[model samples]
Target: MALALALPAWASHPGQRELIAEVVRDTGQDPAALEALLDGAQKQPSILEAMARPAEAKPWSAYRPIFLTPQRIDEGVAFYRTHRALIEDTARRYGVDPAYLVAILGVETHYGRITGRYKVLDALVTLAFYYPPRAAYFRSELKTLLELPPDHLAGPLDALTGSYAGAQGWGQFMPSSIRDYAVDGDGDGRIDLKNSLPDILASVAHYFAGHGWVSGAPVAARAQPAADARAVPVADARPQWPLEQLQAWGYAPLVPLDPALPSSLQTLEGPHGPEYWFTFDNFYVITRYNKSPLYAMAVHQLAQAIAAGVGDAGP
Candidate 1:
C-alpha cells in the first residue's frame, strides 16, 4: 500500500501524478511529501529561454572569449595554487591531470564564485515538467533528486541551488553524477562539493578517473589540412581513426604522432573558416565530462594556459 497523507491541494500537471507515484515507489517517500515538494516548485520562463541559447552552440571565436578570459585563467591558477597539495594528491591517486580538474572547476563555476542561485529542485522540476524538448532527461534527473540522501549533499535538497540545468557545486555535476562520483576529501564524513574545496577537487578528479583520463598523454595538437584535404565525417568524440589513416588522408599533425595511436579529426567553425585538429584519446575523455566538443576544448585550452603560467593576475 502506498503511503498517503492529507496534503494541501495544489495545481497539478499532466505528468506529476505519475512521477510522484514512481518516486514514491522507488524511494518509499510519502506521496504527500512528494506532492507538496512538487507543488512548491515554480516553473521559470527564463530556464526554458536559456535552453535555446547555450554557449556551446556559438562559434569558437565567441565561445573562447567567454571562458578563456584572463580573469578565469588567472583564477584557475590561483585555485590550483591554493589547493596544490590536495590537487596533486588527488591527481596522483586518480591518474587525472590536476590542470584539467582545475579547468573544469573554473569553467563550471569560476572556482565556486558563481555556482548559480536558482534552487536545484526548482530548476529540475521546472525543466522536467515544462521543457518538452528534454523532458524525459530532466524527469529522470528529478527522479534522481528524490532518491538522493540528505547526507550526500552540501545542504538540504530544497535549498541546494545550481545551474539552470540542475547541475551542482564547483564542478556542476548533475544529481546523478553527484550520487555516483562525489567524495569526502576533507575526512569530515560528508561530501560537500559546494564548500569543501578538497572534496570538490577530489570529486572532479574522481569523475575524470572514472571516465578514463590517461595520466600522461597529449590531449590534442594542431593539424594542418592539405589543400586537397576534405573533412571526414565525425559521428562522435571517440577516437576512431589511427594516426596512420589520418596522415594518409592529408590531415597530418604539426608534431609527429604515433602511427598506431588512435585519433579523431574535429572540425570547428573558427573565425577564419573551418579549423581542424587531430584530437587524441585524452580529448575524448574530456568530452565525457561534457558532451560538447566546444566545452572540452575550452577546458583543454584553459588547462594549457594555466599550466603555462599565463594567468598571473591575483583573484
Candidate 2:
C-alpha cells in the first residue's frame, strides 16, 4: 500500500508564523490580516524544482538559441515599431540604448506575451520556507510583498501571478526591484508593469540606468585568439582588465576597439568551436539585470538584430 503523507497547515507551519510576525512587526501591518494572507499561500513543490533547473545552467551553445531566435528578433522589431514613441522617450530620459531596452523585454518575457503562471504568494512562500539555499533572500522578498502598498501591486496579493521565483510583470522584477526601479510613466499615478507599456519600458530603462548603463558604449566584441594565445583568468563578468592587457594576453578584437577600454575576456563553447569575446562595461551592466554571460550576449545580439531591423531610427 502507498503511504499517505500529511501536509503541514500554512497557518501553523514552521517558519511561516515567524515570517508573518516579522513582516507585521516591521511594517506594523495587522497581524490577523497578514496571517490570513500567508495562510492562503499554498507551498508549491514545482517552484523549488524550477529554481534548481534555471535555464542559465545550460552551455552557451544551447542557451544562445533559446533567446536569440529569428522569431524573437522579428517580434522585438514589431514591438519597437508599435511602441516607438514610448520606448524612445524612455530611453532618452534614462540615457540607455533603445534597442537594449527592447531586447531586455524580449529576453525576459517574450515582450510580455508570457509573464508567468504561478501565484506570486505561493512561489514566495515555498521558496522562503522550503528552499534552504536562498531562503533568506526569498524571506525578505516575502516580507517586502507583505509590506507593499496597494498602489504598488497590480492586483490583490492572492491574485498576483508571476515567475516561479515570484518575479512579476514583463521584466521579471522581484519585489525589491519593483520597489526601487518601477516607474509611474503613464502619469495616472500607479505603476502598472503588466498592462501599461510606458511603465514597463520606463521601469526597464530606469533599472539599466540605475545599474550604470553607459549610452553609446560598445557592449561586447568578438576577439580572435593568437596562435599561441596565453590563457587569461576570468573570475566573473566584471571588466577589471584593460583592452591593452587582454590584447597582450593573445586575444585581439576582430573590430578595432579603444585599447584603453576596460574589458573582460569571455570564452564560450560555440557550435563550431570555442568563441572568444571582449566584454565591456556596458556588458557588465547587462549582467546586472542577469548575471549570466550567456544571457547578456543573447540580449546584446538580439538588440543588434532589432536595431538593424529598425534602421537608423535614432532615439
Over 193-279, each residue of candidate 1 has an lDDT whose tens digit, in order, gives: 899988898899888888888887888777888988866899878999888898888887887778788899888888888788788
Distance from true location, Cα of 219 in model 1, Å: 0.9
Candidate 2 C-alpha RMSD relative to the actual structure: 3.0
* Sequence-dependent TM-score of model 2: 0.95
Point out the worst 10-residue segment of candidate 1 by lDDT: 1-10
lDDT of 1: 0.84
Q: TM-score for all predictions? A: 0.93, 0.95
For residues 1-315, what per-residue lDDT tens digits would candidate 2 score against the true structure?
122133335546668778777887788888888877777788898998999899989888999999999899999999999989888889999999999999999999999999999999999999988899999999889888888888877889899999999999999889998889999888888988888888898899999999999889889999999999999888889999999999998998898889999999999989999999999999999998889999999999999999999994322
Clashing pairs in 1: none
Prediction-by-prediction clash tally: 0, 0
